[model samples]
Target: MLRSVFLLTLCASVALCASEYRVKKASRASLNRLKRLINEKTEQQHSDEKKLIGVLDDSPLLVRDPTAQRHHDELAVNNLDEYFQGDVELSETQVEILEKEIVESAEDSKARRRRKVGKAPLYKRWDRTRPISYDFASSVPYSTRIKIRQAIQLWERKTCVRFQESGPNVDRLEFFDGGGCSSFVGRTGGTQGISISTPGCDVVGIISHEIGHALGIFHEQARPDQSSHITVNYRNIPIGRWNNFYPVSLSQADVFGLPYDAGSVMHYGAYGFATDPYTPTITTTDKNLQSTIGQRAGPSFLDFAAINIAYGCNQHCGYLPCRHNGYPNPNNCSECLCPDGFSGSICQYVQYTSCGAHIAVSQDSVSIYSPNHPYQFDSNSECVWLLEAPPGGKVFLEFEDVFQFGCEDTCDKSFVEVKTGPDFRVTGYRFCCSTRPTKRFQTLGNEMLVLFKGNRERSRGFKARVWSDVSPIFTTTSSTTTAATTTTTVSTTALTTVAVEESTTERLSVAVSHGVSGKEVAVKSVADAGNGSARESVSKRIANEKKNAHATSWFVLQERTF
Candidate 1:
């Protein structure tokens, strides 16, 4: 199951340890030393629109958990690509810059990796917990939505893009739903439109953010290894071959002055589970990615500068990443097409070009995996790799990171699609998608979802509309659900289920628009009935009278472990 997080942007007061990303005197000097390419690839500038400033969370992405924090800590010093072989290249100048970036961008170390890092915080002790779970969202109030909205606006101003609400009938963002699985804004398969749900009923700038994600912008703080100053050693991040993971996508619009921005709203505060948050200075380490320091929250001086360029004030001169072609050519790699380093439709490049861990080049598509759930039944419910499925089937893609999107982050809304059964529909997507890992970089189909059968097992494929990814690579191109519930459906050893337990979970519709989805699940048999006690799987207990009729179908609910 892909881990879910409920970030608590609600603050009772200013955090004492709240620190900003600091720029080291030496690092800054080095950055200034870089020689600009005389014949740099000139990028066409998109007129910057008015700034869209919303309240954003000025915190670091680091959270202290046993598994997650430990993982990050190891990453700080890890070689990253031991499993795969790829040539490392750089002229002396390029090597120097790359090294500096690695230094400034280094993430903190996990408590376990530290020989003498400060002790873990009181709230979360490294030894006490495996995966860190920072308590938040509970204390968040509905009104805070405006602050988050502002943060997003500020982000969009730095990265020009259009953000709007879901279609007329539907609203993508909800104000305050404690549901752990709640996402702020995303391109939904729903026909209504790109949706953004906030904690409360409405926050206008929320659309701007949703649009930003659709544009493939990433959180400023989520940059890889930028927390070494916090005493963690993310440098040790030992990744498999082809192992590249960054918080945001390169294609996504930059929030502002970064490569290092301690004040970037997307930043999380403090080190991973580090109780004592440091107070950062106005200048963060020059290298945004390798700075061995923690950053504080708030808009930095450079922040305003970048936003001014991205979002038009009196002058329009920036960019709004579309789903087509041509993106920020900061490195002048545009003309080289597979330039010195970078590949993909719109040049989705990776610093370490190996997929030893998070992703690997699949014969189909690059496949990423979630931790196997505790109760996953092998063979029957085992996670299945799906290239396609009938709309309203068991699994589907929420975004089109690679297949649909070829350029930088784009939310043209043209690619967002969904289907269920015979009803094929299309709707606009509000947010963005990108291949950059620095921006919490994730691609569509980067994660896997699994579904199970209740009555009988059929391996046949169905179809109606073709949108994106499917599960077990099955042909369940068409399927529907009628929820009455209380039915216990399990698969046998022949099937494998992939997913970890989440406080909240999402059951997706196979179709694009909910209208088609509703129709797909129109059958009267499926009900939302399950044993209240069964935590692992949904249990729908059949009524006593119906149980006596031999059986509705020859389906057996067997529990099998993968």
Candidate 2:
């Protein structure tokens, strides 16, 4: 008895949940009115499922006159029975709702008569949960299934809504072989049918187009503002087919402020509904673009933007710092897919720039400031500074009071470059957008190039001082008997560039007994550099050189060739 009572309670719970999602029934009067207008005589007499099928198979006259019956071929794919309102398939509930809206529009039509009469959109949408569910029929081949999955992925990548496989008990899309390729606009409550007729509907683009309709988007040409951009030649259309070109009201069509896009994936081709195959039916404002319209390649950028706007995908990002560099991904709003050379959680990092001023610095010391020094720097600029030290010296650079640019590791946006040589051929130390300034950069070579560049644009570039400082001279005189007591002096120097005060250190002199190549040469310290301020400068500079001693090599040695 207890078990029986539990089963009964569970059944009740399921029924309650089902009722929440059930499609609301239209009033008998409203349904009857729509049936008369559309000429679906058996609509009220049939079952719900039968009624839907009947609507799909019927096509009523939309105009007073139509082409001759001899010319109207029933086998044509573009026949009026293909869809209602050109390609949209409306449910009974939708038709009733549309009737009510039509009544309201007629009452307001007089007031709005003086306003613009451009076509508007139909506003009815799906009653779907956040992510829509879909499943395939057992007869769907693996190859076809792959294509359909790809279509779903394409939409998922662009829009906030997601599509996932559904279980047996849930409302979902069921793909099956039908008379033709088609899908109902938005959701139709329970398990909906999306025809994937083989041979004709096997293309990737076609699959995406059908899925777009199921996602609640209408055709691009059916947009309310289409009249402003293209000419729909009704003369080329058949009499009863005029409903195919019916304009939707602005209230029904939620365009989300996007412009008319003729190249949308949801658009039909130029010959969409041509009464005669040779005559064009849809013409664009610019005749040259006629061929470019009605592309079924994939969703355009605007299409993605509109879907994102509809689902508030970007808004889901909350306080994330994605600005000019990136748009938040709909799937994962916290993460972002940044443009090339940009990275980080919010796409704040810039890699490098190719524009600026070129500066060659060969002086003992020079101060380099951004273009328009104190003011903001120019956009798309490349500036280079070449610093040459004394014959045996290195270049010392330090940041001044101001330094700023778009921050990144490679400094792609705005940055300061300090290189080993006076050109960009080699790698260098690059500094970009950051609150902490760079203290110093001392090059091993006598010549160094400092490049400054800005990618797009930003404020107060950067100010830096470059000074050429000589390492404490270490003179080594080696006498060789073969060359009449020839003397060679070897000097080892260190890099001493600082952001603070200017000072130097003492030099170290060493005595060396030279030997033949590949043999070890003995060396001994001979004397300390001179004392006092002069010696202190040399000593300080020498100390700086020691700090980088581990990094020293033959590259730091200065010598003369005989």
Candidate 3:
């Protein structure tokens, strides 16, 4: 009698939970109607657009339209499916709650326009302190599973969010081979389902994008500040596709103080839902970024930064100092997660490249040019130049002579990026066309980073001159010489050992010597140390010595050479 009573109570609880998260499946008639509508829309799309989409279908880096694939998967998920905003699957209760919020926001539309940023509610965000559980269905393809793992690694590398295979956790994500790519936003009670179809939705960027939704991130274009950056063309949009361009209200999403990013992997392509393929449905305010909007080349630096902020990843190393808009790395608190063109332990150095340099700016203009300027540059190459001026001064740049690269509407193939703004984290102004820029550029701060990327269809690159507004009080060469001449004496009775390591193009040399009392042994090393293993070994040895030698005083100097 007791066993029967317990079973009845358990069954009642399960039935109540099911009603709260119930999804209404589509009927066969609804699926057939949606198929006919898709056929009609496909016939309207231009031939050139179809060809362009086909060429970029398999490319991971290039920007491409995935609307056709999305539509195809939509059928697989079944027509008349109760999908919210095209791809998100929400419970019946969730839909009502979101709808109520939308109606409330619409009532105060005028007030909402004054606000900026978009963020999910705090209650909906996952608890970052705990590991998020996930599992893959047995039916998921091996290749698709690999892509999903790669996507998960990228998120873990960039943020404090942790994920593990499903264990005893009741609230978890279960990945299965559905007809479309879709997921519920944030964490819901019990096991939530995420669909990742094979052949169509297996790209790393696409997988990352879907995982982003599960992490509570909405589409980038849905931000409240989107209107300031992009213009949506409703006339070019097909019927029933206007919902894809709807912007989320400020009350629904938070921007976390990040500016609008056109290159976010979550952004839709220019012709995403366009009936007239020649016209873009979404156009960037900065016309140069037209091709950048729909990029699926992994997450942008801002995307990772935003996630880190959302998950409170920076709190892990609040005591550490990072420069140039960088934050402390969650995985390694000793180091910083830098922007695209910056590196070093604290993001104080420009990312080193074989063809670039660290240039000191003076009142006299210094000429800077791409590698093999006036000649076709090598394919698949990247270079970065750091231009610095004295304190309280700004660097000025002017383009001169020839300027050419692989030209695209959005400068996707090859481009020269100049970062002149005060914030180094955002995407910089890019130039790839053959024509030289008519106007000069000036940095808001004392430093500026210029990057050049070359693709297979290379051409003669650009030439530019840079100078400082204020003359330096002292030359860098003089300052270095003065510091080098200074000396310190150490009074040690015991013999002191010193080791020096240096590498040239031909060989690596290590020298160890002993010094007598009252004499100090100063060791210096220099090299174009492109190889990482040598540095790693040196670091490991220094760390081991520091850990083992408790009584002895040890001084270690490490330098990065480019």
Q: Compare the candidates by TM-score and give the number of the best one.
A: 3
List where candidate 2 sits over 4 angstroms from the true fold: 1-79, 107-130, 318-326, 332-562
TM-score of 3: 0.67
lDDT by residue for model 1 (1-562), tens: 1111111122212222111111011232342232111101001110222111111123342212222211111112223221001111112343264344434542333311211011111010121112111111223454554555564555434333323422121212222222211121122211111222233313333333322332222333444333332222222222121122222222212333233434332233233222232322111232222221222223332333343334333232235341112244322322212211222334332111111111111122222221121212122221111222223333233322222111111111111112111111111111112221132221232322111111112122111111233333212212233332221121122222221111212221111011111111111112233323432322222221112211111223222221
Per-residue CA lDDT of candidate 3, range 387-433, in tens?
Answer: 77767989998989889876543444577888885787777766666
CA lDDT of each prediction against the hidden true structure: 0.24, 0.49, 0.60
Which candidate number has the best lDDT? 3
TM-score of 1: 0.22
TM-score-wise, the better of 1 and 2 is 2
lDDT over C-alpha atoms for residue 423 of model 1: 13
Model 2, backbone clash pairs (residues 3+ apart or across chains), number:
31
> Which model, 2 or 3, shows the larger TM-score?
3
